[model samples]
Target: MKKVLATTMATLLFGLSFPVNTFALPDNDVSANSQVLEKVSLPNGGDSSQSEAGADNKAKEDTIAKKIEGKLEAKDITVWQNDTVNWKDGVKLKEDNAEFKNYLEEASVTDLDNRNTNNSNTDTNDDRAFKGKLKITFKDKSVIEIADQKLYVTSKMTNINNSKAPKNAVDVKLQLGEGVKDSNGTIGQKDNPVEYGSYRIKPGVNILNEEHPQIKNSLFNLVKLQVSDPEKYVDPQWSSGSANKKDFVVSKDNNIFTATASKLFTMTFKFVGYDRDSRKSIEFDKLPQAIKDKLPQEQKIKEGEAFEPNKFEDTIKENSGEIKYEWKFKDWNPTKSVSVSENKNFEGIWTRSKIEENPNPEVKPGPGKEEDKKERPEKENKPKDNSKAEDKKEIPEKENKPKDNSKAEDKKEKPQEENKPKDNSRVEDNKNNKKSNNTFPRIKSNENKSSSNKVYTRTSTKETKKESKTENLSKTPKYTLTINSGEYEVLINGQVIKRQMDVKPLIKNDRLMLPLRSLAEMIGAKVEWDPQTRTAIFTNKGLVAKIQIDGNEIVLSNGKVIKMDSKPLNINGRILLPISNVANVFGLTNGNTKDGIDQNIEWDGDNKTVEINLNK
Candidate 1:
């Protein structure tokens, strides 16, 4: 997915922010935030000759407009920042998901906001209208704010395995019926998406479920179920997680999506095995008469519904690699149950065959038996050998055991009470040996002294006296882990350490990227992981700020205020903060030296006045 803005954005901005949508933007046309740019849509292009006949000017306008939009939709459209344009309908065009995917993959690592473009002042073509901004990308690397609600997007495209696409791709996991929330599309009713939606993988698909704020080769379609609304769209069943309609059972568990149909003995998830985006085309139509007839009025023979009508019952053949399950209106049959060939967590590899690690190991497999066995791999019991224990017992020690005759010898060689000091020497020798044999992993020492000359221990367990003595090698006064329950960059005292916005999905050296996890452990929060969303959402009565480690929002649980660097930032899974900054707004932001970090700002304090260190 090429994230390039293709033609120079200055040119695009000139084109978009101009008085007329079709006119060229000259360099001298540059303007600031106050100018209002007019919006004149292109004429229609539906059958040029037909339009030339003057069937109607409005009709002609629609045609021409669609043609231009078609071109823009094929690729993403970026405009100057903060240039607000209130377009009715066709005046707006869509950016290609591919480019946005690539851009985000790059942005996450580059510590790019991929948000708050309204702050950029250098898009030579930025005018009042057509705000010079990047076209809205979907949910993967971008988190669209609809009504200021942080919504995710699920997107997928092809050739992932061994394919050099993206690595740290943000995967917006969705429940069986959730849709992603997106703020950048034509949702019509509101300016933002109402509820955060998610995606369901259906029956047959797999994706790079590695990291968040992801990198991707393509966000089109290979094997992925992106739950997105562009407006964070939700489905009818979103509210209803499970509904038992007589013989039809639709349920989703873990991350594996499963749809079970009784009469058909079939699951309707194979639309993707064949790469068809809609399940109604295949699964909905195949409903049996007994099943179809028994369907409720809301469930049967509907028009204008998202589901398609079936000729009969839903029959789908899905493969989980190791085992293939074929389902029809009656029941499902296992076609073949061979060992899955990829990661053991993903499959059942024979120990003899080294599990060929797939660069793009399929994370989500379609239907059948994979639902319960995805996250927790089915453990195979490896037989243990007891020969070593038996051999040791048989040898009675390889050096040979000392018999009763040696006991008398030991007594004869024993020293008297006056030799106690010599005995203490042996004890000291044992202590020395133990110290020499100590085998512990190396830990980086956090002992650098600061100007205060006060020794501070970073580990949270040093409050106990025993621990204090072990940690008192330095003179820095000890400090406690004291961060108000709000999203904030990991800091020590007033000094800045790690600046983060969204600390949700983090990783380092291939480990669970933990800021909240460690913080939670330090502060004590009953940690809970929602398998459905793959989100590490936890609750603590002591107040844990749901800080946007990647975003600028450090929402204090108690609703206190903190000045911020900018808004909030969503950087590569970790919510980044401006170390020296604070946050009070309902959103996230980042900062520049020009916009210096704010510390404990009061929005009402003379209109959000920020206190920044001027001395640098």
Candidate 2:
């Protein structure tokens, strides 16, 4: 049968100490009729019958006195017995019955007092009921106090046939039972229970099993021996007779129990490319094997929980390589030290095609290998005498023909020159002459001039000219500009020029022409348009550049002039200047161009893009 083992063991283990009154009671008063019981006799039989009857009567009275001893040991209690009396001498007994009754009452009260005094002495030397508070403390800083708790100790009979079974086969354990409750209610029950594995019974025995030897002993002896002789027949070996008899009592020095609860948190890692595409994510379990191997076993944080911030170091390092399948982020790179905060997500940005290198470039034949091969035989086998005569004859003929052709060509070029305005053509011719002589021509501005009668003169000075040329070279700044044809966009030093222009930059006559004002501003220069003169002037840091509408010549602050093959044009009300010319005049080229300037510019014909890296 299932039974709840009482908390008797708990009381023993806890050793609840209860305060009992130790003061002694005064002696009871001896009655004047105390000799009456000695004279009383049995009504029937001989002397043997009367003696047996008195012995039986005395034994019954002693049992009654012992039962009420704990209750009436004090001095001022009244005792009264009212039962039909049996007497052999009816006349004599009736007269002396009052004395006998008083005597019996006095003896019974005195006997109870004596018994209590003796029992108190024995209890002082033996173990008594434990009465105190049972305290249960939890790991969560919770405490429970049970007041007036009792600890019962008892033993069971096992190995029935063995004579020593009562002593050796007894199992002693403690039980707190339903009596143990905290402020929240019962501790080890369905509604309110201790944390799993937190509660424990003493002697390491399962208290829930009713048949457990100790539990059986406690239950049977304490519950079954109700009418039996507890002192002699109860489980004396396990009963709480003395301190030594109790097995499950908690040690007075350390009476606390301990236990733990579970906690949990989350972390996420995300990988993204430069353009925000090629995205991937990893959770604790979804992490790559390489990353998982390097990570601490305990690094797997629970979802929605908190963890140490540095736990992902090794894992990030192991997976760093995987982030760059063939590309990386230009601005941000993932590192081993990258960490995700508790409950936070981390993302790494990478890029593709940011840096590229051609592995095997094609090697082309140098200069004129084929031409040299074809001309080598001609050099060895030509007729020397005939070749000399032919050279002499052809030389004079070629010279005389060019002279006649020059006269005709000069006449033919005269009309073209004459067709242009006189002042402009004369200035152009002077500019050309200065260019041929490797000198920059300066314009002598007319101090006395009429708007309609504009005149121009050329001036040159050795010292002033040299200073002007040097000033142009020194004041210009270096920068890079990338422009795409058919797209009205420009990148200056990797930064896009924000202004929008009506016309896009394009390639014309092998020269790039872009919006004059935008290009000027992009290079930290200012542009002013003069409608009257149809001229656009660009100036930066005291250096000035002037380009007239449909004019092929550019004028600088030092009056140094640069001639462009393509003249400036006004498109959509915006002057478009030849970029190659402007770059040259400003000394912005890297000297790689074919004619007017070095070809510091790279032309991607396929994409129609012009890239200029100017190093001034």
Candidate 3:
């Protein structure tokens, strides 16, 4: 039966005038008719099918060589960061998978589908594979190649093994996402590359999965790209640590772009100093070395990492050689502790001590004056007389006075001179007293005046001594707070404040709020709570503020009602006020970036600390 079928098939083929080599034979079939047909199809009975196949291949190569060359030519392919591309996509070919297979079938000499299974020793291009080098030139003037995968059907054109395309697309993309690269390879319309941005990569396609192995992770600048505009721009600096450029690669030549997708992102934290009053930047170099050493160092933290700012003294005594004052560190402008998602700067707010003349000026002693002061007791002792017999002391000398007979007779005859109130005698007595005591003349008639002078001298000396004591008492006390287990303890000038409470600091709407009574009293403010109204009245530095629990409006003594970003909270019978809001009324400030108001509330949220600068 098989022989008859073979003969009948040959006869039919012959009748149609079909060439024997034109129709291939089944490898499994072998019969007498087939052998005869084979001989008739070729001269000299040679294996002519191979030659015929070679002829057909030669003809096909001639017809489609230009198309193949075009495919080999570099194409300008724009792909999103971390997106993958195949040979077809790289050549800017519009053909789909089916269309690409058809093209290969028409151009290829051998059966490409069975070539792998049959293991034929055929030329690589003849088996429907891409040939020739794909040179990829990048913006940085670097060059690379797309490794040949031996089959052009679905092989990825990337820089994985030997190819020179970037291991990550971000290394070459002008922007982060989808966009058209102009002829000059610029991504956006901006004149500068730094301002360039791109649209987000199409979701579900570029996502890292089994289907898309080229994309290692999500792109970094997705948010920046989404909010970009022609006028508004996002910085495209790939090296600020937003994206990892270690294994980045990209190349474009002739129009071909070969890039793989990989980029990692992380956020950074830095400490900056700012003037609390002016809200101006303070040069870190200008800060005292002591303060600089105490500040938190800059650090790089990945997203969702735990970050806590270190603590610093609220008031630091600073000396500028010629002057002495203090730099009071305040709370950060924005926040102290944050969950890192973007680049953040935790600026330290500071207030300078008020410049004032020294209350007690030193009276520098002169050389002679110092000696005189030392010898004052000796000189005073020398003037002390032992005898209390006032009259006997001087009367003995006056008893024998002026016994001249002739002078006495003249005085008796001139009764007018004798009756002249004895002025001469008193004058001589006073002159003798002055010589003995080295004293200013006393008015014998005004005894109260002399006594009052002595009292005034003593009073003035006492007052001076009292003022010195008062100055010592007026020194501002330093405070340190320790918060743990939702409770806090205070150390004022190294002495515990003795007031303890179980209240934790609250963060609401990005603003820090705390218990008012402790902070107010520490800063020398008197706090009074009204149970009926749930209000706290604060009196400090001549300003009064009445704040109600769970309310945003603050009624000040000056008759102004100000609304706060966050209201006062009542937690566990303790009233907590928004420190940033009421900082002003209590002679404190927690600087406002929007209003340009600098603050002096020394708060470190990371350590759960609040420092009071009484001097401010």
Candidate 4:
């Protein structure tokens, strides 16, 4: 029966193309021909028709078994889901490749109960859902053992297909099973089969598990990201869901991410005014419409919670008059310029007092201009006569009068009576004396000399006393300052002022910045601050000095500008200036004391004290 079946199969397969000469040959010839045919027979069995038939059946059975086996090629199999798998043409199988059979024998499957609706299960055996342990050898020669994963083999007839997969390439889809763990205990989730092309697989077990586990939740998001080089930038995306916040998480190994955040700060302008009805101060957000209309729209400072200093001027000009506003920080007027910054509140108050009219109205020269001018010359010259009279009073009468024996005698006898009223007898005597020719000349000279002497003596005595008093005052010294470093207490002459400093003296750029008010007062310099210009003016002993905040130049009364190494600073409601520079400008000498033991501006670092002795 097997012989008949083999013959029928052959005829069906080959279409009966065999020659009939073998049957017609003699027995010896047939034996010889049979031996030759035996050499070309299939290897399943021997030359006998029965054995040949059995071999053909066995071969057919093997082919059918391979189709149902569902053995996967161990190549680029991925154990994790959501990973990209590359495909390429695979190596062809050879009969002599014994190593491939050993690899297949080692591969075992774990049955997975779940079925993917998108693709049909290649494994039809209901008893065993496919599961496997495959040893994958990577190009780096490292090996990994993957377990608890289902393996599916796909051919052209199988339902599995990928448009991106290489043509003519046999693919293996690796379906990860729940509770599937690698040798390293990496858990796997149920996912669609990861398809890999034939080129990626080897005949043996291919490890689908990656060496390093997939890191999740390792992405951070920035609300806004900025980079200097946009060409080399890469947009960051979250691992699972959309970024919900302006913050991101980074991996422990990768700790650096560059980004810039958008932020805003507020500046508040608080306008304060005195309410006449309430007799109390009021803070308002809006100015009166009348006041607002008078002000230039661009120059008008809007009363609001947020304001810009640069947009408004220190003083607003109106058609009626100019209104000056003061920025009140601690004082009614701050010495420094207004600086707007984050969350800073600036308080301002408009001047409430009416503008004063000029007390002396200007007189314009008009129809009476010529007569007024003529009177002005006479009025101007009148002071010259008074000045001459004042100068004449300084001379002593004794120096101006001619000394004569009679007068000397008279002065001695009537010293007390001389200044007293000369009675009617002296007048009659002068009249009689003027009547004599030669006697009148001498008598007239004596009378005139006595009259001039009396007037000069009275004025000279009073003027001499006034000059002596002024000389005494000029000999006395003005105020003096004695400073000790690191101590706020300073001695103004003999009086010690304690707690006068807001910020302690600081040394910046090898220069000392001290409180301007205290230093200027001690040196007899008047200090005044100009808010509009942001300048501090110091006047002492006919020398004027102007130090502007953040200005590097100091102007002097002599029209000389001194360039300084550092600008003036405002600290804690006080203007601070370079002490040495100010001292030099004010003509304060820097030298040692009389005893030569201590310097004038001495710095004791050990005690953190600065001792400054003026005029010592």
Candidate 5:
């Protein structure tokens, strides 16, 4: 049994790494194959801090680490020679593999500098949020390819490594293609099939999966790539002919792309849709001559049910004015969706929204568009440093009072400020006990809230000294809660918040946990986490209301009520709000339309004056 297993290991792994034809072991010699297996090395799998990489890449490598690191398949993880962090490709260290054993043991340490200092994007003083794109490259070869193109990706850096370079080793959860055979030779997906078999490694004969992917297929879709070399591997301009790189011309036959490389040299081949290499090949469904003619001469991509185009509307307002744009749908894929074309009518919206027109060099806090580490508020406790609430944000007229000095005098004129009931009315709320300070997080709004729906804008204050608690505050606070609306840019007073997430202080399992809804408030969103369904649903006034994690459907609300569209997507055990929709919903608009240092809002039945600045 050991001999059989050893032979299987060599036949499987060695054929993938290094040169497949360098060694010699006859087909009948079981012992020789075992020797080859003995030579196969696994990675150290230890934290990047302990790895041989330099100092900067160690710290935050884990915190910044992407989902890829979790897919490794080795016993002890270790680093590789290419300076690539270990496990990025799912390779782990083995107790054996003495040939490279020293790499893990002798690995250097990355003593990280604990200073929040960066000349590039760092402003320890002003406190800014950063959105960086990371693209992972394997020996400079593309791992997950799509859009008729061979792509390269960079995983988010884990904070484990202390080195300057973002560290966190990468991991690849390599799985067999849709129709490929597994170890037990089952011939189906999620089921192991292929009973261990022996093959000569002389021809570098790598196994092909149902998708016609070669061994350790570099084109897996486990992680999305940010940038890639499209000229060589992209699909044909259409689907029926050859791709001409000169004029960026293409054929309609683009479906799958294959890459062949040797150290410095690389080449990509395009496959047609419905080609012989498709997952359909596993079924051998007899096809008509027309269908046969449509397939390419090589491997084909797994045909999908065409892209479902959803309608979208973008509205933007500036110091200048407001503009609205509508978009139509044809067939939209990820690559094509972001890439605006001449035929696509996004320019009108882009120009009006000022995304292209008014470019801000300084990055704002909150999430970045699409994947990677989204923009988040610098969790730093700023803005709350100076000034009191009423001083900065004068209450809206309805909440405060219009030009009526009479109302301002009433709130203050009461030499008896002590007798005023902390009041059940929100400083924004219905007559209920909802503390604008408690339930409202800074995005979509709070969801843990049992059915009551209300959004309030509150300021954040840090405690330098602790005092006796009051009836207004339920308990001694661990973290302050603040809620802001995306209607216009939210402000505690007149200060613009870098983070838009609503921060809620709650007692969960006895310990306080800040939920996504509160976090959403800071960034902007009314988030609801459903324990019954293990899902999170986010809603906003006129943006896309989406269900995530377990969201099976998405609903877009132009300005109406809640609704569902397509099935929600599950990602990283957490649901992701659709980028465009979520951003739009949580985004703040200018609140005060009238004149202002602060607008006059009337409160107390139009008797009080609250200064409301629409959008600060």
Candidate 6:
């Protein structure tokens, strides 16, 4: 106890001699002691202010050492050295060849410079150099910086003119070399240059004089040439008299086109009908054979020339009965031009002028025409009465003769009136039938016969009207719902839906997800949302389906629950349900091919389109 008390008293004296911070502390407490130790001198005779200056210098060096991102995109090309090579058969890149892809990786980089200053925060008084680099990347994401790396490609020209230079451009031989970049990083050096594919000067193309055909089009002017021995190799030179003597220039990476002017190309102009609502084009080849035969024979286009498609401009009328389309030329795809050096195709676009149901159809008899048919017999009787009155005037004495003679004349009229089968109402109302009506028993019999005939006519008319109504209902066109994947617009019955959808139709879990409202409205179904439950209800033709957001089961009005391929997604506040689930709930089924029936739903995988055909 005495020794412990002495030790405690000695510790207190040592703590009091030095301040509270004079005692050594754990590393975690360094921040708490930082302020108090800021001015403390180092054991090596260094001040805290000097140590902070060194820290600032180290931070600045780290800032300047950051990397800058830079990349370059270029086209790859091939040059031919053989004079016998054909230019008409233009060269195509063999993407399958591994060696051809390597050329893209071996592209040269030169004249590296860093233009970014944001990485470094050097003060105006500081004198440090920026060390950023220009990074050139390739298709494979491989990077190479500008350095002292060089790659070489060599070729030899054949058939040099020892005696004199050939006046014709076709007689000149060529060599193939690689495009190089100069020290300034500019490409297209003519010394040890790459050759353009071989071609004989076209029949009418002129390559001489200041306004040469090749120079007029800059594409052909960049061809490189060198005059050397047929079978011997010569070193490429960059002097005025050497291979660099040509005045033409090339692109950084020469992009050879698909076709050259050496071969004849065919140009055809097509006048096609474009329906904007359906997004369908009716080409000339799709027209009926009978209509095609009736129109003027299609004009044959000459090769290496452009022509107009005006032959079919006024010949095609929209009376074909297949589709109610009145077409008028709207515009052209590639406008017509006079230049005919290469293959040029022009399409004369035609669009539907108006939506017409039936401009001219067969006219059926109306109510007024039926009245006219009934009144025809009365009109005929009027002319006959006038003739009888004339006969009375010729024989005035016979006017007072017996009624029996007149009855005989009236009996002759009965046969003529009965010949008019459809004039029953007019025949019953004849003014000269008093004698027949006065006989009570005969008149009663006639009345009953006339009433029976009237009833028969009315019954036949009602039956005919009912049949016509049923036929018209059957003739109504089917409803078509067309939905293109990744498209916001939906088409119904060849007409675009006026309402726009918030989100495009998409595919998830190998099932197509369609908007609930659009899909329901397309098939004549009503959609209702229950916000409290986050559920959507679709009702159509006594069928109801209840779908909840993020739920994989669909409940139907028939008390059946269906397991769906995917859950309904709530995207952008709009519910999207799988099409297969909706289809099953709506009782849609594929048609039997053996019965020549069209399917209710069609899925086109290639075009990513879904078509639902519904019967009314």
RMSD of each: 39.7, 34.1, 23.9, 22.1, 40.2, 27.0
lDDT of 6 at 468: 39
Q: Candidate 3 has which clashing residue pairs, if any?
A: 75-255, 75-256, 76-255, 82-261, 137-252, 166-249, 589-599, 589-600, 591-599
**Residues 1-616 of candidate 1: C-alpha lDDT, one tens digit per residue:** 1113323343554454323333444445556223434432324424334433465565645532222334332121222224332211112235555653344333211112244334432212222221222233332333221111111122232122212112332222322222432224212222232433233222223333322122222221212433343222322221222342221111233332221111111112221111111111224334323333433222221111122223234544445467444444421111111111111111111001112234223343566325433322123111221343234345534545576436434433443432454453343333235454323322212222222222223434323435344333232121122222222332222222222212343323322222433333323344443334433333554654444333444456677635444543334322223323321132323233244443222121232222221111
> Per-residue CA lDDT of candidate 4, range 1-616, in tens?
4345455645665668443442243345344424433232445544556665777687765542233233334332221122222221111123434654554334332222332223323322122323444444433333334445442332112223333222333333322222222233333333431111112211221122212121111111122223222222223221211142322222222222222211223444445554322224545544444443333222222122223343343433223336432222221112112222223443554433223243222244465645543453344345654564344443335455555445554534452464332332232234335353534323444244333322212123224445444333222222222234334543321223344343567778977777776566545577876767978889888889998877788999899999887677777555678877887887665543334553335555555555554533
Q: Report the candidate with higher TM-score, 3 versus 6.
A: 6
Q: Rate the local accuracy (lDDT) of all candidates.
A: 0.29, 0.38, 0.45, 0.41, 0.28, 0.45
Worst 10 residues of 1 by lDDT: 344-353
| Candidate 3, superposed: residue stretches over 4 Å from native | 1-474, 483-499, 591-599
Candidate 6 residue lDDT tens string, 133-177? 334444444444533221111112112231111123233322333
If scored against the real structure, what TM-score would every candidate get? 0.16, 0.21, 0.24, 0.26, 0.15, 0.26
**How far in Å is the alpha carbon of 196 misplaced in model 1?**
31
For model 3, residues 1-616, the per-residue Cα lDDT tens digits are 5444555566664665444554545656575333433434444555545556677677655543333333332342333333333434343333445643455433312222221212211212134443333443333333334433343322122322222222223222333222223323534332233333221222223221324333332233222333133222222223321243332232221111212111112333344454423335567777777667666656655443334456455777777777665677754423322224445555565555434344322234457645644554334332332232233345535565655544444533453463333443332334346455434433332343323322212113234445344233235543445445444443222223223443776678977676775556556777776656867788876888888876778899899998888877766545677776777665566533244432345666667665554543
| lDDT minimum window of 10 residues, candidate 6 | 149-158
Q: Model 4: what TM-score? A: 0.26
**Best first by TM-score, ranked:** 6, 4, 3, 2, 1, 5
Worst 10 residues of 4 by lDDT: 212-221
List, in order, the clash count of every candidate structure.
115, 22, 9, 13, 131, 0
Shift in Å, residue 16, candidate 6: 66
On TM-score, the leading prediction is: 6
What is the RMSD, in Å, between candidate 6 and the native fold over all Cα?
A: 27.0
